[model samples]
Target: MAKLDFHIVNRIRAQVARLGDRAALRHQAAGQWLDISWREFGAQIHQLALALAGQGLKVQDKVAIFSNNMPRWTIADFATLYNRCVTVPIYPTNTPQQAAYILNDADVRVLFVGEQAQHDAALALADDCPQLERIVVMDESVVLADHPLVCHYRDFIDTYAPQADVAVLARRLDEIRMDDLLTLIYTSGTTGTPKGVMLDYANVASQIESHDQKLALDEGDTSLCFLPLSHVFERAWTFYVLHRGGINCYLSDTNQLKTALPAVKPNVMAAVPRVYEKIYSAVHDKVSRAPLHRKVMFTWAVNMGARMALARQECRPPSWLLQKSYNLADKLVLSKLRDLLGGNIKFMPCGGAKLDESIGRFFHAIGINVKLGYGMTETTATVSCWDDQCFNPDSIGMPMPGAEVKIGENNEILVRGPMVMRGYYNMPEETAKNFTADGFLKTGDAGHFDEHGNLFITDRIKELMKTSGGKYIAPQVIEGAIGKDHFIEQIAVIADTRKFVSALIVPCFETLEAHARELNIKYQDRLELIKHTQIIELIEKRVVELQKDLARFEQVKKFTLLPKAFSMDQGELTPTQKLRRKVIQDRYHQQIEEMYEESHKRSPRPH
Candidate 1:
């Protein structure tokens, strides 16, 4: 049932041949939509490959792409593979030091930079990375005249002979094998140093094949590409979209998503949980401030939509009256939610971290399919995702076709399939430690399967906390439970080697401010506002109510209200909005220590 049997290059070539004049990819420039036809895409890739070859790129030479999501990123990626070169992707949010480490580790020779930031990062690493010879800048706005090593993307491609034959590129494509190394994706390194996950042509091809079997995306579909292309989830998902001959809309600025979504009206998209969480919060906050009648109407519509959704999932038709209710619900409320994501979104894939069940259900209740998925960089982005008919908000769904998933020792999720990466590039010991003897990659995530075979992730194995009382706690579970509160924007649970659980909380400033205004409470700034007793009591009450499902020991006993939220720029969050636990702990050591101190003083134990 695999949709693809050939390698990625051939697959893309086939798409170009079959859908020659169609818009294969689209991006906005100078406030206008521009489309690149399949034929043009193919030609650009060919020219870029030859230009790379002219610059002395050889088989297996590492080519680094440090860029935001754009059409040129994919063109450069496929062109590298066309020349039998390895593509090493560096996240756009990565600091210059991080970029230097990857470039030096991968020994990248030619780096394709997207904009001024990435180009500057590459230039900063010039002295450190001896192998890096040329810099191809994608953004034409960047001005670099005196530099001999740097050139605009168009100018770089023009350097190659125009008469270069397509037959030679065809011969090279024929030489490619399924097992040949294709890309090196570095881990986000929340815990420690980043390691490059080695993936081959077979790994990517197999994922596209398996993924197509699970999801029914077709040629007519359009996917919005906004997440960083450096992440495997977006990168691989984009590849699948291209293979299906779908139009890809690239958003260089994530801040423009709210505007872009309605403008593009994409049929499909994938994003991290933060995006949906923000959307969910915005929707609820708006409804909360609405008139009482409007609030009641919205609630009714949501309930009706949920009923209709359940009926559709069970393949049962709703009764005539219920169907009429759902129609009204869609017209009055559900359709407005859909409009936020460009009304045509058939389904949007969410991954990179655990999605709160409340947020997931809310999307479903509004007639939007937020297919919660599970995977890591090592699995080529998707190990499992919701199927066409069976959708579950609590679990990450069944394994992708041709992929095997099972619970191993410590309840860690184990995976075995062609989609799994070969190993960590140049780190044999780390790679060996990551896999079982039989070749199954040990995904460090702890999870179990339901009777219907849905995978429910509990927490990360390494992130599990052990209290001094010898009880193990899943921080993510506690975080997910309380983090969905209307007033709490972000949370991090702390319990390792401690007597009880605690949290560092970031209040939803907007909601908190509105509440403050209603209560006639005034403060100079966020610091003074979070210190207000009334605000603390409000968040505390919400936390207590939310933690009712948690066991006594697992409940957060004490918490500190942070004045600000964790951010990727501060190195406290990863590119995907996952909190960097160690970094956050280190940065807030004073606050964490104070919380434990207060707990000890409040509940002194006999020695």
Candidate 2:
């Protein structure tokens, strides 16, 4: 049976239809209010979908969408899926070249862009990409000029669009089969060119079911989205919000999340570790500058949080003494933290990157539910997610229903389920290689399942390095360890055919600033600040602290902290913020060599 589900969207239409003036979408445009209803939303999507079809767009064709999260973005995406065409999403921050590659790889037939920068990128490739026949500008207010390839989104909809007739559209929807390929997302491969991971409609449908079962979704649930909808993790969550009948209030941008959160007043969120890290930093910064009484109280509460986090990480119940201390602290101290989150926040599901275990536990201690999850694009973005009822701070929790997770011979996590991707698109050999003959998707991550079937990700296979001296080490291990230091914001370890281990770091600028203030030192920029003898010594001391538990050969011999932070736009980081070690090494080969040479010079001579 080919069953089509209205899922979350259908329920919203039924309830809100009774209220004649209720708004389904609220937009603040140029400081003016814009309200849309279920009727208008449906009409807009139906018109857009029909327009696309009228323009010779066929089922299974790739339609490229490049934009930030917006109301139109979701409407356009759902319409594309409804028409049985695939949607390839490009991140807003992607450079022209990166955008071109994804467009070309997918053989995109029509492009819908949100801004001028994205339009310029698409225009740059118009001559080269034969498959790209049309360009629809989402921000139609921009002048299209005389570009033959460009088309205004609203104009196209009105001109050639068929009048939306819902009954007719439902029949067209029947053409979409469950197993048909629906989308292709590129995994930001660390070593080589990023590969496109193909996912089918069934994969998405099953994932929706899994989330609906696991998450405590209620009729009142809503999401304030800031994470790039282009990402598999975020996109999947967005779809689930629609499926669960939850309202999605798209944030303008990640930078504006703090201001936007209060306005949207979301009940639930799924975000990456960096988002939580920023929140933690913001709180810590405030505490550092608070009045004496408030500072003392904040510090005391934070101490209790730290201890509670440690207990959760170690899977130990808090001692009665500690529980009493934390409970009393929460009422007077931690309650204020909730107020900052608009006092309505419920679940903040963290994924995309491994969160520092302590960070997750700290949030839990403060009565904030920050559950963690584990997945790669290969696993359709979620293998396991923390179950609140049976929460374990150290584990990624049990696999979602119908998803099979097993440890392979090499201790690599193997997954098999409807959520597993069809394989890398147009790369048969590569696809064949990624799976075992028995057909499990071999995730290139190193990890194991616990006795209770909770999953843990230990390291990445590709991140494991072998030195020229024949010593092997997991760079992820060293990087993860270094990242735990309060002074380091980001860390990337290097040991690929090199004599020993080294690291590239981006320091905590706020911490550095405070340290400089205490020492009566002044620096104009991060570059100058990093070169200070005091700062270098502090970081070196931290490296030594992390090395205490590591094998001598795996220890960091020397390090360098960059002036600026790593960024996706700069090509230093993937969309997911994973360090591109090869790119970093090549960009600073001489600096790394100098650090290593300086390391030996600083060592005492052997008698």
Candidate 3:
């Protein structure tokens, strides 16, 4: 294959000339949607590049973006790239200490923050991180502190951009190399301190080529940038969208995704499995309460849709009778479901966690293509994704065109590709340990390929639990099954070296409260509500039903319900919403112990 142009700055320049006045980015503010044209986007990147250069930021200097999803995030990202500087992103939900660790570790000279919260966090870190020289606030309405380092974004650009030499910035862009560090994305640190994954322009460039070959994105397509740009999944997709000349509508507040979906009417987007799972649960919960006739109609429509979807997966045409049924089904029920997701979805890429197979199949059955893929920050987002013709809900789809994947010792998924990261920044020993003697990156995930070449992930090798009876269990598989219940919000399985499996569960309070009301159960607060025998019984019944397919030894024998959800702020969840198993086990140690003690008292040698 021929070498691809990996220079991002040149791509933006070419896009500016080609797209001219077309909308390149969009954002919602003050109850209205706003558009930033390609020309405007290019100009902003140029100005910010010049401003950073004027601030004495030299080549390869690290810059940090501590913001939620917004158009300016991408502007700052490209600006840093144009100046040949490495960009480091900090999750907006990260606490002050977490954000400070990234800043100090990356030696970030300039920090771009989103709102007052991030601004305040950065202000608090001023005394701790001495290398942080400048703070540029993205939201103009945020009140600044009296510190000399802080400046509003408008003034920052207006003051420095004009004085800086544009020719010098352009010269640096022209000198771009494939090995230039594109970004340093710190891991969520589920187990320990976050490590900076070093990704370069070559990694990103290969992703662009692979996605272009697999996905059906077009120049006129629009994408909803729903996931945080701090995550590699969204960041890579955003770059690809720009490369394809697609419009990227940024949603700063993720809580507004339900409202924004219809408002934006995006053609393509990328999101984690949690988003799809919630939507799937909500739709089903609503349908379960509908009138009998409506319920019958929904069931029939879904069955018909499923038949059509299966036919397509087999690369066969549906029969005339089935086609007619599906058309009517689409009009009556499926289309309404699709409308909730903007109704114009060409495809929505899902990753970051394993999507429940039922939820994956349901979305595809309703004509909303949810392409389940797999990857990590180290792989620059996508190792494999479902193409148009590949539609197996049980698999993570085929490997990328230029990537090599195989099962190594212990069934670990090993990968060697141009898209793989350089290594962990400043962690030479850790990097050396991750790669094998011949250079395949040990992914730590256990999976296997089917006869058709589809990859099916089994479990995380490090997370597998071994019972005292010598039974090995995959926690994610059990968690994925039980977590699909509408009454459950989050779960963490605890069974490593134990005689039986147990879990810490957080209920979907909204659904639980509604059920409580129906049952005439009274409670003063969430804590009281969870302790009610009727509430516990309700959850226990659901758990038993959901885990019926699992082996007797692998089922969750006991569970404790918490009033609150696992959260990033609490260190119980990663920024991507993955449970930090160790943190949860440590925090709920007593509750877990009590469950096992009670089980032992009931049956001394249980299981």
What lDDT does the true structure give each of the candidates? 0.87, 0.76, 0.89
Report the C-alpha displacement of residue 31, candidate 2, in angstroms.
5.1
lDDT of 2 by residue, 1-607 (tens): 1233532233333434543344455555775436666567666776788887777666788998888877888777867776778888887777777788888999998888887777877777777787788888888666675688788888878765765554445655755577767788877666687688898877877787787778876654667777888888888887776555566677655777777767766788888887777677667666766799999988789789767766765677999999999888888988778767766777887888788666676677677777688888777788888876556677777888989888897799888998899989889999999999888999888888777777888777767789999987888777766676667788888788888788778898988888789888888888999988888887888778866777888888777778887877778888778887778888888777776684544421111
Candidate 1 structure quality by residue, lDDT tens digits, 480-517: 88887778899999999999998999999988999899
lDDT of 1 at 216: 75
Q: Encode model 3's per-residue lDDT on 102-213: one tens digit a residue.
A: 9999999999999999999999887888999999999989999999999999999988888787788878987888888989999997788899999998999899888878
Error of 2 at 39 (Å): 3.2
Give the Cα error of residue 296 in candidate 3, in Å: 1.2
Between candidates 2 and 3, name the one with more favorable TM-score: 3
How much does each candidate deviate from the true structure in C-alpha RMSD?
2.7, 3.5, 1.9
Candidate numbers, best TM-score first, in rank order: 3, 1, 2
- All candidates: TM-score: 0.95, 0.90, 0.97
Candidate that scores best on lDDT: 3
Task: Point out the worst 10-residue segment of candidate 2 by lDDT.
Answer: 1-10
* Deviation in Å, model 1, residue 380 alpha carbon: 0.8
Which candidate comes out best when scored by TM-score? 3
**In model 1, where do residues sit more than 4 Å from their true spots?**
1-5, 161-168, 599-607
* True-vs-predicted CA distance for residue 272, candidate 2, Å: 0.9
